[model samples]
Target: MELTLANVMGLVRQTFADPRGAAQVVLRLPMPLQARWAAVALMAVLSAVLMHLMSGLMPPAVGPDGQVLPAISPFFWAGMVGFGMVMTALLAFVVGRWRGGRGELADSVILVAWLQFIQLLIVVVQLVVLVALPVLAPIVEVGAVLIFLWLLVNFVAEMHGFRSLGMVFLGIVLTFVLAVFGMTILLMLIGVAP
Candidate 1:
């Protein structure tokens, strides 16, 4: 299928209805490995740009000490997001293989990038809601979280050819916990507070 605007919208709608099927469609896209990585980078940059724009619309965050925390730069967020996408793909490939999964790194990369794209669309909707109906922002936030988790679980299941979504979800949660713990330990080792 082509990457036209109409196709994307259709895919988004399909994703909401059947995330695993949408993931299958995404994985079937005729893109090379390098292109998949490029898509990941592009999605990261796009997401960061939207985040920067949204931050400008919202009030600055206040720390526990009542001091306003400095806003992060878009470039910094973009780099972090790109690194996250790459690492997620790598971990999914390596860990999935260890668990008898039959997915490739390229498939993981494209799926993650597509997930980011879907998130960008949700962010756009949230931005619109925040501006037009501020009271509904909380509802949108809740919906976004649900959509993200739903899509992630389905995408992982599709990528690894797993039949049980419950198992995929459990694995995702465990991996997330381990990743956070590892990151915390690494930060401590480097004398940085998480």
Candidate 2:
């Protein structure tokens, strides 16, 4: 199916109703890799901007001399988005294959992009709650994390055609651990860590 607005909405609704089925449908779509990557990048930038805006509502981080610290650079957001997209796709492909799944890199990319899109919508809701009811922000944030994780597990299982959700959960946990380890090594190399 084409990537039209109607199709996207329908897919999102379907995802909420049946994530695994939605993932299977998404895999069958003719979305190109460049388009999938663009979607991920767009979501990343939007998420960063929303987070920055949300942070503005709280007390600013101040230095010992009472000077406010500068916010993160846009370049940092871009780099993070690039790294996340690559790592997500790589992990899904490798782990999925290890589990005897037949999904390709492109399929994994689509799955990750869709997941980001869903989280973006959730972030918008959280932002609204933060503005209208600041006290509920923490609750909304926690709920969003749980929802994202649940959706992620189902989507990963669907994408890889895995019968056991446990395998998908394990894959996600392993991916996260490896990603943290890699980032730690990177930070140490850059002299950002002791």
Q: Per-candidate TM vs. native?
A: 0.94, 0.87
Q: TM-score of the candidate numbered 1?
A: 0.94
Question: How well does candidate 1 score on lDDT at residue 131?
Answer: 98
Which candidate's TM-score is highest?
1
lDDT of each: 0.92, 0.83
RMSD of 1: 1.4
Q: Model 2 Cα displacement at 109 (Å)?
A: 0.7
lDDT of 2 by residue, 1-194 (tens): 88789988999899889989888888887778898778777777876776667677777889999999887666676578667777887888888888798888888888888888888888889879988998999999999988888888897787777888887888798889987898899999999955
Write the residue-wise lDDT of candidate 1 on 57-85 in tens digits.
Answer: 99999999999999989998899989888
Could you say which candidate leads in lDDT? 1
